[model samples]
Target: MAPPSTSKLEDDVSVAFRNPSHHSNCAAELDNKHVNDQDDYKPERDARVWLIFLALSVSAFLTPLELTSVSTALPTILNDLHGTDFVWIATAYTLASTAVLPMTGGLAEIFGRRPAMLASLSLFGLGSALCGAAQNVPWLIAARAVQGMGGGSMASLTNIIIADLIPLKDRGLISGVLALLWAVAAALGPVVGGALTARPGQWRWLFYLNVPIVGVAFVLVLILLNVRAPTGTFSEKMRRMDWIGNFLVVASSSACVIAITWGGVTYPWQSPRVLVPLILGLLGLVLFLFYEARFAREPIVPFSLVTNRTSFSGYLQTFICPFLTLGVIYYMPTYFQACKLASPVRSGIDLLGFCITLGPAGVLGGVSVSRLNGYRVQAWVGWTLLIIAMGLLSTINEDSSLAKTVAYPALVGVGGGIVYAVASFPVLAPLPVKESAHALAFFSFCRAFAGVWGVAIGGTILQNELSRRLPPSFAESFPGGVALAYATIPKVASLSEPARDAVRAAFAQSIAVIWRVMIAVAVLGLAVSLMMKAVPMHAQTDENWGLEKSRDGELEGREGTEEGSDEKRIEKESIEAVI
Candidate 1:
């Protein structure tokens, strides 16, 4: 693959620009066979593009809503299902969702975006129906796992579809809109779940609610999402997929998630049950990486993606921001419920400041990046705000004012929002336009993977501290440890004078440790953010994957005509020179 001669490239590009229909022919003449630096390869803005985008936005909204809504209804679900092992309810969904993410890109590449999207939505709706109809703990956990698989895939597909429909320079606004929907859905989830759970036997509706929404997205995609896919027989498509690579990653992720979900909760961190899986999972991930780099023809994660410094830095920033943001979001409610003695509903209401600020900040950050054509500044501002906010949050105590409590978390939300909205820019900026699907699938994987660590770290820190700090008499009631801290929040408010005061102080002190750790994480995110170079964003779409088939066919015919004329002209010049 030698570089094209400068004169030759100039000739091809000059001819291509004259007739936009010949863009593909010109790209084919280039060494890389894809337009890399060109800014004029914009897709035609059609009504169908907006229609497809609307479908994707709905899909994005459904995912986080399902993920967060379940937390508030878990208690009610446990009681109704007679489940003592309530941890499995959440863990199952997380494990399934996280495990399936690495395979989504390959699936999309092999099966096509429309098919992949339709399949994910189908799984999601089926899983939701099963969850709503569950009779016992096992059934519900199994159903949740199914639901999670779909949910995770849906998240990845939404981002991938956006990349297909939108170019990098214009993507900021679309990303902002999706981020807004995601934040709003998250903010509404607990409220929606709590309201449903408050009524007897109504917790089922939490899962059931996703059905109609999925149906709408499903039909919209089935009809309107007519994007191009690789044309091949079923077996040929399957052969193109990186099956072994997918298996290795999925299995390893499941193992790691299980260990993280159970560590310091169901079992001691030192216990062989937790230690063995964690060790094995790490080794498996290493093996998967090796296989992808050395053997797999189509890797789930391409080495080109992380080998570039800017893209690699983007991945690091992506992982760290979510890791800390989710940690803060999970534990902040502990502060309100345990120390401030706010009820579950009240704590959710109290969290409105954080939730509401995040959506708009994300929108603002996105618009700024699009207009300014640089992401580094927003990343710096976000990480700086996060570090400051985490430090301020560490100062919260039982006696902290409502305003102090409200304002600090809101600051965190703002920082997290900006970082989250623009994180994908750096990841996509350094890669070829065709790599968007794989890159974004891994991007979604990073966010989902970070969430597990986020919750685990906060839970582990809080559990260990609560065990050491709570009174021996009070701690004795829960023998397995207060790792399930939310379960303990209700009992904390009902205790007598000295005991209640001691519990609240211990809870505040223990929770402060989480915020303090996040300050360091935020600082690390800042450092990672600096590693990203200001690579120019692409203004083009991958020409092969557009939805306008009639337009594409006409362009192809015109390109063939141009290419034939060029070949004839070259032959004529050769004959004349010989004469």
Candidate 2:
């Protein structure tokens, strides 16, 4: 792949621009040029690549595991810490990670990818260790913040590294494998957490587990990963660091996530706690946008990349679909325990269907894309399955059978696998190789941000629904607060039959509401997927289409040239319309 051209960048700024198809040869020519400079670019394939994948996969595992694992242990953590703010354990990590995501791409670029990745793993492991040793709720929250910072880099950088090693045509298959790993980690988290909480002195073991894995990953990366730096001196690379841009991104995202997580949970949406941060986050975002557009040498997120309708719409679909899917994953366990009266262990086991199906579906989707080269069909299939899953889930009730629960989650998991397989392809396919890391990072960032909103919105929905459905007789059952008392309630076997029945009825209604909202979100995502223009699957590879060489000897493709001058006219008009 060739480096990006300032000339093309200028042309992209012109009032008239063509679609990507018109310049299909650009990517291919650039790839040939890069291959000619094979001596300068030593592309090695050793067993180390798989080792790197495994190490990064382990780091990635810790992220979703941390998120899901804590749910099963929240009761124990709250009791042991003597704290009512159990939500902080999850929220703090999420908020910190979301805040730091935008910087990972830039950091990887400025520093070598290997160094940046190893640093992320080390920080995450240290934070996990700290979390295990925390004596109080504050310490735990602080430790989680450190973990979040490390997690931010891991989530984004993993994809960036994958993009670096794998060709676009093969990325779908690799991405499928990564998606499977993610699903497994997410699904297994609760079970592992439950087991640890159930065993003596094992709750701390959850965090401790990360230490050895990270240690091994760090050592392997240091020894095996060979990353090429940009053609510049150390000072030149340092100059490109974009510290101000990174700071602005972190501040804005952190504030926004905090507001989202805290709103309607710890504080009223309209209260100062929410309003102040909301306003500040928005202001910081506006400033960041202004800076990126006007002043930064190498902006963290480029507007031109995001402004393209295909990329923009694809990103939105990426964000909203996962937001709804993960929202369900986060809350479904509660429904199983509260409504079905299942044990925590049983609830965790029930979630395995979703996790187990994801691996095969993702692998299938990846293999299918590799053979067929057309992602549009897969996108449609995914959306259809997602809609069906959401629709089925909406029918859940007080006496819903366990079979329906398993079926709905599995369907959604399959859709998730397909979506993950195809979603990033469209977003990354159009860009030059140099921009791939940034694009991948942005894609991951959007998903992480979505996860935060998913948890927040799902929690709010459940809380509100439960509040509305609470029995009048139980209104005085807890003088302190219903939310607090609800937190303490164990699996159904712990409650009397009548009390269990009441809780089940309330939980059933709440889950139904949540599922309805999920359906709406899924429908919106499906609509967005429809709007996406279906590019040919052959367009996935830089080697397939010929273009030219840029400075870095990577493929340089000419895009936005397919439509006639009239189409370019339309592009300008569309930009104006949005403005």
Candidate 3:
């Protein structure tokens, strides 16, 4: 394509800024009601905008709450279900969430954010209701999967909405506030679950609780949010969606989740049960990539975004942080319950050290990025704290004091808050205005996928260690030996003091292994962060500034050439097709 003359490019930008709504269609964005970089693009602080933000905040808090809420209540849920589907119960929702994420962008683009968000909330509420009514483990697992699909959409859209309304300069502060909701929810999920599971049938309340809360959010969104949608019939909208791509994404993700979950626990690493799904998943993912890049009319996740150096860095960091964070969130309770012999409620209380500090740090980090005008240095400090926190965690054992244990994980929570607050900006800030929503969808996909892997990794370690050690350790006085010991917590009356001590020792060692793995992961994350393009506080970067610059550079050589006219015509056609 021939590059536009400098004066002409300038003219377009000036006019576009002058009236984004009027000029948006000529270049690329049909639905960018407000361009992010223009002064007029700033989000309104009107009652309506804030009300919409309120609805978003409620769902933001609830997503993490639902995700982590099941951890502390697992033992009780397992016992009551009378089945060994504990891993499935835990992984199903996360897996569903992960699978749905790749399609969220396309779905939102076709349906509009308001409808997509409302549909996700409705699915989540329905899934929650079903889970509360479940009579068996399988039923509950299915419901959780359903719930997770909704959560994936909710998580993805909340940030998309922010990008939709708020300009880049002040987004960090608002993003920080949103991160606070996540921090609080993540912190409180297990506590709420533990408290709910205090009685015989109390676990059901965790799911039942979502009904009213989602209903409230649903009403808020219904009344407040009015997003722009394309003009199309129902069939046109459906046809425009990347349905084949969506199916492939779901299939590959499901297979990957299965392989990850069963790598060593359900089957040995070499067994077909593990290897087949693992290999199939890898191949399917490859096929999905090729299909999206070469064949799909509209890809659910744009391959171009992932290929960008800056965007890839953000997604990679997002994935690794959650993988490590959930590794701690899921397994720390095991340490408290088995080693310290704390009740579920008490163990959740012990976690307050980590939880209490996390939200403040996220809020601080988020606002600081805006005030300081950059993300690089804060990220460095955040990663350093995370690595330090992991190192401290490596020292914990069965005999560790409650205060020390609390302090170690508390450090991790703080670091997590700091790093994650500004993580998405790199991907978002450097993109074309219209592409930000797709980037946000990919970001959510990475985070949700990481949660599943985190749990799987932690569980694999704990289960492998317990399987290796429990039989010998418990042989002295415990008749049921390893199986019984691993199934029940140390506080159970059937286990004698010696047996309980042995079980606790084994779990503590396994948890130490988890911490070690996380240290390696955190170090890897640090290395990745170092290589990313640094956005300094003083850069004065625009949301879509680089895209225009890059496009012009690509077309520079074609300018004034004989082939220029044809190329320009093709480029314009491509832009219109996508829009």
Best by lDDT: 1
Error of 1 at 458 (Å): 1.7
For all candidates, the clash counts are 0, 18, 1
Predicted candidate 1 versus true structure: per-residue lDDT over 1-579, tens digit per residue: 233355764555566557666665443444232234233457887888999999998899997787666765665677677565555676777667778888899889888999999999999999999999999989999998899899889999988988887899898888788879988987897678767877678889998999999999999999899988878899998898898988888888778877876787778899999999999989999999999999999899998899998999889888898766676556776677788887556666677777788899899999998999999999999999999999999999988999999999889889999999999999999998889999999998888878766776677788778878888888888757334465567677689989999999999999998888888999999998989899999888886677756978768856764675565455334333333
Clash list (residue pairs), candidate 3: 373-537
User: Which run of 10 residues does model 3 get worst, by summed lDDT?
Assistant: 540-549
Local lDDT at 210 for model 3: 89
Determine the backbone clash count of candidate 3. Answer: 1
Q: Rank the candidates by TM-score, best first.
A: 1, 3, 2
What is the descending lDDT order? 1, 3, 2
Candidate 3: where are CA atoms >4 Å away? 1-43, 473-486, 490-493, 536-579
Q: Each candidate's lDDT (Cα)?
A: 0.82, 0.73, 0.77
- TM-scores of the candidates in the order shown: 0.90, 0.83, 0.85
Clashing pairs in 1: none
Best by TM-score: 1
lDDT of residue 25 for candidate 3: 62
